[model samples]
Target: MAHDSRTPSVPPVRTQKLRAAVSSRLWPIPVFAVAAAVALGVVLPALDQAYDERFPEVLQVYLFSGGASAARSVLEAISGSLITVTSLTFSLTVVTLQLASSQFSPRLLRTFTSDRFVHWTLALFLGTFSYSLTVLRSVRSGTDGGTEFVPDIAVTVAFLLAIASVIGLVLFLAHLTREIRVETMMRNVHTETAATIERVLARKPSPDTDAAAAAGSLSGPEALAAPDGQPVEAATSGFLTLIDEPGLAAVARDAGAVVRINACMGDSVIAGVPFATVWAGAGRFTAAELEDLSRRIGGTVTVGFERTNDQDPAFGFRQLADVGARALSPGTNDPTTAVHVIGHLSSLLCDLVERDLGDRTVQDSDGSVRAVLAGPGFGHFLSTAVSQIRHYGMQDVQVALRLLALFEEVSWCDRSGAQRHVLQAGLAELREGIGQHHYTSAEKQTLMERYQRAQAAVTAQRGRPIY
Candidate 1:
């Protein structure tokens, strides 16, 4: 019944762009490392010959005049050692890849293994080809053979650089992957905390807007307007106002409290809907108290002008007397009183019910009856009864009788602590008005009979001990 309507403000486009920029900065390290690896391994090979031709004299010292024999033996030994080392390194890398894949994902392992099978098979083929090249160069340059067809120094340097680059890329990728995993974990924690707060707020009493109110103020979204060209509020400390049809307000006050429980300020309270306004300080107490206050008021439509969210200590709710004084001030003659709004709404709802039920004389075919108790018929009758009961020191009797009558007609009523306390307080006031324990003999006898009859009926219904 109470709308906790708050608009959800859209996040700024600039904020999204900033977030994207930060993410790009964090994730680009892997890309740069891969690019460097490509340059060192693939690009350097094409530039080798130019650097080699420029260093021909250096090559001559290592290759000419019987020094070629020693160079040949050393080249054979170095090439053989490199082949063994690269093979061992590749095998270890494959083992590491399998272990990592199994730890994280089996499907990933299957894909990686399938793709790398061709790479490993091709590398093996190239190793054999390079070995054959080495043997051909040795054969062509043996003894009196010329340096015209020999392998250049650039080829050896390029091959070593390529292997080292591949190793570096693999290490860099591992570091980037760990960083991404950590970032993901932190994001999930923040999301879960936000969701938990939402779930807890959804179950309590107060306007559903209370959740949004928990976030910010109602003014940020669809703010309610007060009548008489002034702000209608309960208390300035930390309250706002909601105005709606009088009829709708009464139903929410009496039967729709549950609906409002989900609403908070900064929440969605639709227009043309009736609601109660309540004031709260900062935390759960204000929210809990508002629920208690609404229950005490019974069937009246109430505008709970209260803080939608947590409030500052200096600006929270003050006493009602203070509020009334503010209302009486010359600058603001706001006729929109909280009590008036509630009373007006209550009257409207009662009028609607009277119209629906018709006069007391109208009876249903099943012997069930509805009495319109607002206007001329039972309305005047009950008003007179209230006076008579008050004059005779029988307020408890009047209240009990009215309650029984309501129970017979209505299917249910809220039995919240605040509502029951208000009813009991009303009975006490009536007793005080007529002087307690001052009933006449005949009145006492009548009261005793009514009590006995009511007890018997209750026992029959419950089919158990009254206690």
Candidate 2:
């Protein structure tokens, strides 16, 4: 009959079987193992002796025989082996950790020393410990005089390997540190340039940002006539001057993305003519930021558009036209059209002196009295002659025209009467063309008066050639 039970019940047959198995093998198994080990140990030594006898020179022999010092010898050997192994393990662990953390390449590590050196060093330290242990054993057993032996060659070699590894790791770390500094500096420069350009385009110079840092001054508030007979918000026209001029070098360096040197004080820089090489340095700022730099630097500077590589619309020349356009006071005519016409006229007049000045070239390596002359018109003729006042607005423009004319008046001219007449004729032709169809009534009247005076001046200077 079978019975279902949750727990196991010991049966008579099972218990007897288990007892029989334990009694049969447990004691004999341990005894057999000990006997086998003893047999092997004894046989191995005898075999080694016989082999050495047959081939004495070829065999490397290590002997420990039963004697007064035999126990001490065995203990010393064990100690030495343990010490060498321990030293080797510790040295290897240290070197491996340093190599991984320091990021030194395998070849660089090779420049230190071979793995064999590490093993040798470890062996030496362990051998020293083993020698100490052996000496202690010898004293306890009363075998031989307690003496310790550690190989000097092994210990010295280990020390040298450790030193080399450390030096190599230090050098690698130093190189990485230097690389980080250079990269960081360049990044800062790039960021600054970009921010500068952005501020310029927005026409938003940060008084706050500027106040915090030491840089140039802010442009003064602009003034324009208002209907209330007071100054109101008006666009500044002409070559907007940069303040606290940092000179050309700063401009070229800080001008974001692309920078060019167009006009210098003496040399005429035209609106569109590109000059100088632009390269990456300062932060790649947007147009507004560059405008800020330009405002600080003082000059006819243009801040180009964001993302776009071409010149900005608010560029020097373009801004001048915009400002002039804004200043236009409309009568019964098309205000926008009038502004456009006036703006073009203003630009052309300003461009005249700039163009002529730009064209003049010095000749030769000797810096001799050679000159290349260019297009005509000094602001002087238009300023004093009434022609410019009718065509353009702004006191500044009138003043600039007068100064330009005065410069011409003071200069020496070599021209004959006939030559003067020919030049006057050319002037008349040019004036008529420039004043035709588009000029306001005031501009036309001014042109006529200026033409009459030009004829009279040539008549007076008949002997000199109009150059």
Candidate 3:
């Protein structure tokens, strides 16, 4: 119900879901690389034709001196080798995906798929292969009723590409090996989630704009209840991936309606399910206006097969939690890794506690609240980050203690105490969990003391910044 007045802002032209798709699944960049290489492959041969084997002395040394037969053989060899390498690369990538899914969590496939190293490696191999093949067709032999012609510069370029592809293969192998390590995977996840946090929360709102008009503030949700509103149904069934909040706000402003998004980022919606509700600004929307509004609103909310970090911070937390839980599972029994993961989770949760996070509202030029989006609170974030870990690590003191340390660290950052109850609830659960297991009286005493100290710190730190 609170009206956040702000200036006009432009929403993203492309949904983050699409961006993630482009990066994670492969193909887009390689397609581009192939196109570029093919263009170069076609153009350079023409230049060779222009030279007619009469190159300037300065360029003579740089040109391929091979006869047409040799040039054709070189092209044939390069193309053949690169295609083989490309196939090997794809097979290795598939195996890595399997290894990542089986050894780690299935969710980890996203991390592996999104790796630019792999993308570029594939791009190089495909590009080199396409380039060699394209240039190979341009080579001419006098025996075929044509002047003996060799694309000197083109063949030279192909030779260079073959070398680069060879190096890329070596580098790709090394990079793939490093990436599959649990430690490396977790670190990469932490780094990416940290970036998403900053991008979603840290942008300074321009003062010239209204109260809620911050650079990245429009990037999330803060759902406000819609007691009396019309249902805005979704067109498809899928997980909510991205929303163009600024666009939604603009639509609401135009229709003079208050757009209340009913679903949070990452929520599933079935076809015909109302993911949002709309309230008329004055009285009500005419049937035609309402129909158009529904269509536009549906367009702005993108549903995909899976969740993405684009606007959902919880997805990041979920990924980290999965890693932590997977590590603590008996099959893995890697308490050391779980401990490290908890440390990272602690960092993300602390950021959440210190942040002034809440609902994101977009206001119109008349200072009316046009859009209201719901976002996750500290409770959601804390539980997402730790619930599974706490459950799986209940019997492992190493995990139990690291979790306590996480509570302590988070307590220090939550000087406002806004998340005190959430922290307290987490501690209570941790306490109950420790008791469920056969933690000796001494271990119980130690954990309870730590819990009590955390409670005390939470109380004392209230209304006080630790800085």
Q: After superposition, how far is residue 395 of candidate 2 from its true place, in Å?
A: 22
User: Tens-digit lDDT track for model 2 on 15-82?
Assistant: 43344333322233334434543443344434543453464442223233244344445445545555
Q: How many clashes does the backbone of model 1 have?
A: 33
Error of 1 at 314 (Å): 54
Q: Best candidate, TM-score-wise?
A: 3
The digit string of per-residue lDDT tens for model 3 on 1-467 reads 22343222323648455677698878899999999999999999998788755877888888789898899899999999999999999999999999988877888888888889999999999999999999988888889686877888999999999999999999999998898888898888888887777666543244465343553344333223435578888889998878777678888867767788878888888998788889875666788888899999988888888877777777888888888888888898998888988988999887777554656666655445678777667788888888999988879887888898788888888766778888888888887887788888888888877777766765665623222
TM-score for all models, in order of appearance: 0.21, 0.19, 0.90
Which candidate has the highest lDDT of all? 3
**Superior candidate under TM-score, 2 versus 3:** 3
Shift of residue 348 alpha carbon in model 1, Å: 53
Model 2: ten consecutive residues of lowest lDDT: 217-226
For model 2, the superposed segments whose C-alpha errors exceed 4 Å read 1-247, 250-260, 263-275, 278-426, 429-450, 458-467
Which candidate model has the greater lDDT, 2 or 3?
3
Residue 331, model 3: lDDT of 90
Give per-residue CA lDDT, model 1, range 307-372, as digits (tens).
211111111111111222232334533323322222222222222222211111111222211111
Scored by lDDT, model 2 comes in at 0.33
